[model samples]
Target: MNKQAQAVVMLLFGGAIVRASLTDMYLRYVKESLRPFLIAAGLVLIAAAVMTLVHEVLRPKERAEEHDHGHDHGDGKPHREPWVAWLLILPVLGLLLVAPPALGSYAAGQSGTALSSQQISDYPPLPPGDPAKISVLDYASRAVFDKGVSLGDRTVRLTGFIASGPNGEPILARIILSCCAADGRPIKLGMSGNAPAGLANDSWVEVIGRYTDRTITDPVNEETIPYIEVETWTQIDPPKQQYE
Candidate 1:
């Protein structure tokens, strides 16, 4: 596309990045250090726009001989370029400036709201009172499907936000998904022991604890509550995105 169109697209994306960063949504979905890339890209687009403007103003008028080829479209007609060509810069600028945040309660109750219920027989058992090293997706998947069976009786640590559930008690929660937030599934964690005082919904926390299999009968279905008997609860910043 023409430089002017490209510049406009870049500006649009730059605005989006600014909005996302200011709202902390970028941190939720993207790494913090990458924000500068957006600003740089936007500046480049602005520069390109200035260059295009200068070139249009400074170019000498074409002589009549330039049209000797008998072209139906004369040079006097303004050049037109597709707008889509300029759109390419948007994603790059958006990522560099402010990546989108992880899905939160806004997507908690949609269809495909839980992880696959496959038997996790291969997962190694956790040793009591040890810090568990697992991906966020694996943790969420285990919580959703395996629940009691997956956790069994073991001490582990998990980090995520306190998401709202149907009931009033704030359930320790995390998201698991096959793709983006639109496909995210919510996994509720059972919190035990002394939870940190003044824990609010959406507050980020790390819980080091053990698991107990408790059967919870939901109105929709019978599910197991894989309870985490909290050994210690520490507040922390939430990740930018729910899924890696």
Candidate 2:
């Protein structure tokens, strides 16, 4: 690849980043807090490409003079980049053509729910509502550490995708992201009672349930994840934001 091709590839890559961020598609890969940084990075890439092209076009005479004077570092060869560097544009092309969906049940089933003391105390008080809406992370923390004190005797609603447990039981699960999909981890709650009709892996669903005393211990590591006594469930389309 030459300088011009490299610049063009940068421009395309930058444009794709900016577009994804602006359109909220970046949520699939990164947290909302990273929107500004992603946009800034895209703009910097675009500016660098534009400046490089401008300099080349505006200083044609200087380049010609350098060439005539054999200013090629006296190596008898002009600058050249390795051909493999052109592969950088493959990501941009894939993003443009496919626009892959966010991580799903397959990833959730592969990992155990991670718990920490600091995270257990970080959640806000349970909000006011009939079926108090709460995140999977918050639920996991309270259920494991506090023993569902805040959630006692109250119906709670959780929205997430269905993941198959090791024994093929349907579990309500969501990916918790600190920064991006690369670092995302799954937190899950086991559902009791009948699963909603047509329940399948990766299917988004809203579960109305209460925390149960039953705790599920992972067979591999013995980490305890809580269970919920489900009252009812409704299948729904995947939300615009897929991560917690």
- C-alpha local distance difference test of each model: 0.57, 0.81
Cα lDDT of model 1 by residue, 79-110, tens digit: 44445665587686756665445766545433
Q: Candidate 2 — which residues are off by over 4 angstroms?
A: 61-80, 117-125
Over the stretch 155-231, how does candidate 2's per-residue lDDT look in tens digits? 88889999887567888889989899999888878877655555779999998888788877755355777888889
Against the true structure, whose lDDT is highest? 2
Model 2's TM-score against the true structure: 0.89
Q: Candidate 2's error at 166, in angstroms?
A: 2.3
**C-alpha lDDT of residue 225 in model 2:** 72
Candidate 1: list runs displaced more than 4 Å. 1-6, 11-101, 109-112, 118-121, 125-129, 135-152, 177-179, 193-197, 215-225, 240-244
